[model samples]
Target: MLQDLEAKALAGDAEAQALVHLLRLLRRKAYQEARAYAEGFPGELRERLLAGLSLLEEAPDRLEDPLFAAEREVLLGVRAVGEGRREEAEARFQRALALDPYHHRALTNLGNLYLERGEVEAALDLYQRALKLAPDDPLVHENLAALYRKKGDLDRMVAHLKRATRLKMRPPVSLDPLTGKPKRSFRIPLWVWVSLLALLAYLFLKKP
Candidate 1:
């Protein structure tokens, strides 16, 4: 796990380096330190890493794929969520699904919104769809664990929790730096993925 991040960080992948360093600080409940470290970054990155409320950078028009469009909406929805704009966030997530139904992040995020609104069945459906697309995404498993616990299904909840934990313990060679989450080996357009990595450097950087 460390090797992948280390290699990328050494190779000047600023996003990976930021994640590796900030995650360590945040996990230790060092919010000030995390914030300070984030401050050290230049320009928009520093702001984004501090949860600045800007729209996610637009993807290049040449991409011309619905998946990149969907990803943009998903990242924007994530930012809206951080800004506490639940209704807007819901709209954005729904729009993403309309563009590309197979978008894992959009599905998972929409499921999370539904779960928060007490729409258990709706959330379950979306989560299941997301799991189909990215079966090894630890966030999906963790979310399923939460959903099962809410339904009073202790067995299923415990199973998902354990699965998520095990996945996290393994090396995150294919980690999604945007969210600091483990991901399965699935192909995504390189430009789209890089754009996401650039815009969402703080998607998971909540105050500890």
Candidate 2:
């Protein structure tokens, strides 16, 4: 859908062109430019672009899209952390979370902050909330494991470590929570699998 928007924008659609610009700004690190563009969205332009965004809301998690303010603040917080400005980073993440309680990255980063400060209980709560929202994230699993270890919860630590290992050993998969089954991927045609297995068996039998 975004690809289609790009095509339309390139072909002289004014609304698509504006929306493409907004998306570009969203992805960029230029806070001033992005904010200015967002603030200046005139009535018609704003509605049209919002409609375009709604058109792209095809994912199961679309309802919780992060606000632009929350996204920018989280981005700044992430950069600050990389620069070792721990205090500023914590403030930024906190502000982002204040604006959007369900901002997953902000929660995870702030949890890291607490964990670094030896606030085991706070960090564990944030990590658990984050993991609840993003259960399949291996890095989050590792972080949660470390948080558990900080509090001497060996069982939980081992569980998260095992989950992280399992995720690492497999191709990306999403489990259906209701049934605890992995969602199937696009399958190879059966003939291709059979031929590959036959070739592998022949080579194995030929080996010493």
Top model number, lDDT: 1
Clashes of 1: 0
What is candidate 1's TM-score against the reference? 0.53
- For model 1 the local lDDT of residue 12 reads 93
Candidate 1 lDDT, 1-208, residue by residue in tens = 4456668989999777775666444323344555656676678767665552122233322333331355556777887999999899999889877765556778889899999999999999999998887787788999999999999999999999999999979863543434443467778989998989877776656536
Which lDDT tens digits does candidate 2 get at residues 1-208?
A: 5567778989999666765566544433333444445445678665543543443333212323443555556777887999999999999889877775656677888999999988988988898898786687677899999988888999999999999999878764443322223567788999999999999999999999
Q: Please, what is the TM-score per model?
A: 0.53, 0.52
Cand. 2 Cα-lDDT: 0.69
Off by over 4 Å in 2: 1-67, 173-208
* Clashes by residue pair, model 1: none
**How much lDDT does each candidate structure score?**
0.71, 0.69
